[model samples]
Target: MSENIGDLFQEVMAIKQAGEFELISALIPYAGLVGLELIKENAGLITILRNKPSNIGNTTIPAVHGGVVGALLEHAGIMHIICECDTTRFPKIINISIDYLRPCLGTMDTYARGYVIKQGKRVTNVRIEAWQSDPSRPVAAAHAHFLMG
Candidate 1:
């Protein structure tokens, strides 16, 4: 199987159809392994981390793993850039800073949305927020910079 996500990205973007954005996650093994899905919404696309037993970290609190939350935040930013930006290649992460505001329940699905703070020639800055149950109450938030070139 080809592992070139950029090629797949180009193909998907060319189609420009709703529901095709999920294919972008297929080229990313980690996203598939974690059951990440890109959902097209009225506002824009949102990333969802499906609830799974493996994602649970604290059995008592039944919280999702911190690593899992971080991964979702990062992937949300990537997907946002891919779907919204005019890029032929996958963006590289320059740096990311994430804050965990509340415990993410592993039993429930997690949703994340990213907004582009700035898109420059060489760098793009994005802010992502993850929430469960309610969008008003976010479980985690992240700010990430990606190398667009």
Candidate 2:
């Protein structure tokens, strides 16, 4: 997988056109493990969904794990950068900071969007927001920076 970023990018494009969001997990295995799916793509915006029982960390509150939320945001951000730049090299995450605003209901499917705020020759910054039911009431938000070459 590390040696085939270009191939993966091409596959992603085909899947996007076909509206086969489920196949994204197979093309990007980490996404498969995390139950991440590309739901929509148009222009420069992309939406991601994650639904898996293993993602829930607090059974009492039925809340998604903090780590899982973080992974979803980071994964979305990386995919956005890849699709935007169409680069052969996989972007390396430099740093990220996530803010958990509310409890994400475990029984619901969570959706996220990663917006590319700025892109330079070697670095890209992205803003991510996630919600379960209402986009206006996001459960978490994050900012990520990636080193692209």
Candidate 3:
């Protein structure tokens, strides 16, 4: 039998584990908000967040807000939990940490990529990176740690 994507997170618990914005729009509102009317339902997070123009996102002076950038990172990582998880249940966010490297420049779009470094029975570890101009010159990167029910 083929593996149903929904079955991946069948045992997830915690309100935060409900990662998909479309699943509970009222509850999540903007699970992956990008400011410029972002789409929160796309399953291809790696490409979805690959590169977003700074124009679409909020900008502060010459750079974007630190919080907004961090959201982008968290959003990218959490998307994986939602897309791969089964509707049988929801997954939750336990703890996450992000590090800023470069300035999110204005007028330029940015890109982000997320990968699952590890997925344990009770927790998941993900790594994400956001870059502008050059992928090698990343603007921000993060390592996410999530908890499951």
Best model per TM-score: 1
The 10 consecutive residues of candidate 3 with the worst lDDT sum are 7-16
**What would the per-residue lDDT of candidate 3 be over residues 6-90, giving only the tens digit for each residue?**
5333433333255443343233435434432223435444423323454334544467667777877777677656555432345
TM-score of 1: 0.90
True-vs-predicted CA distance for residue 108, candidate 1, Å: 0.3
Residue by residue across 1-149, what tens digits does model 2's lDDT show?
A: 45846766567678656767556667766777767876555554445556678889999989989999898888888877766665657789999999999998888888888888998888899999989889899999999999988
lDDT of each: 0.89, 0.80, 0.61
Rank ordering of all candidates by lDDT, starting from the highest: 1, 2, 3
When 1 and 2 are scored with lDDT, the better candidate is: 1
Better structure of 1 and 2 per TM-score: 1
TM-score of 2: 0.82
Best candidate per lDDT, number? 1
Pick by TM-score: 2 or 3, better one: 2
Clashing pairs in 2: none
